[model samples]
Target: MSKITNLLAGLGGAIALNVIHESLKKKSKETPRVDLLGEEALQKTVEYFGGEIEDEKTLYKATLAGDILSNAMYYSMIGNGAPQHLWLRAISYGVAAGVGAITLPEPLGLDPEPVAKTKTSQALTVGYYVAGALVTAGILRAVARKKE
Candidate 1:
């Protein structure tokens, strides 16, 4: 697939993931708090650079943007191989990310509660990534079909 196509699909998936996460977080206590993790990481990153962020809202916004951009690039890798492997690539990327999200925080000095506090949270976290990856794959497939 073309780079532009890959990027557009990746952006769509990333946006969908964020939308789902943001909406569910306000309504469910068990929803994955990936945002919290992101915010913490962002604050520490800035601090590491000798800068401090005093405004909570700004920090949150920056974290959200960072999440979307990073995820977009990650999902864009789904287009790296033959179209026949699209589903496998999507699932592999999504599951890897989901597992990483829940497993990597504590080792990195960030709290894990936001993402892995409970089995439900962990499952939901993984589900969200899978959904995002499927969205990206679906977009690519649709585009390919239309071109044919």
Candidate 2:
């Protein structure tokens, strides 16, 4: 795939993931608060560098931007190989990221409860990632077909 196409597909997936997460968070307390985790990490990183945001809103915006960029880059890996494996790559990347979100926080000194509080929370977290991946794969396939 062309680099532009790959980046666009990845960006779409990341946006989709955040859209589902933000929507669910508004209606359900059980929804994962990945934002909180991101905020915490950002705060620590800032402090580590002797910098402080000191404003909640600014911190949140920064974290959200960072999340989109990082997630897009990570999801872009799905375009690394043959188009035939696009779905597989999407599922694999989504599941891995979902599982990692739930499992990695504690070890990394961040709170895990935001995503792993209960079975429902965990399941929903994974579902959001899968939804994002499916969106990405669908977009990629559509573009590929257009090219063919």
TM-score to true structure, per model: 0.97, 0.96
Q: Please identify model 2 stretches exceeding 4 Å from their true place.
A: none
lDDT of 1: 0.93
For residues 20-139, what per-residue lDDT tens digits would candidate 1 score against the true structure? 899898677788999999999999999999999999999999999999999999998887899999999999999999999999999999999998988999999999998899899999
lDDT of 2: 0.89
User: Which runs in model 1 stand beyond 4 Å of their true positions?
Assistant: none
Clashing pairs in 1: none
lDDT minimum window of 10 residues, candidate 1: 22-31
> Candidate 2 at residue 146, lDDT?
93
Q: Tens digit of lDDT per residue, candidate 2, span 1-148?
A: 8888888998999999999888788577787888888899899899999999999999999999999999888887788798888999999989999999889999989889888998989998888888888888888899989998
Model 2 worst lDDT run, 10 consecutive residues: 22-31
Clashes of each: 0, 0
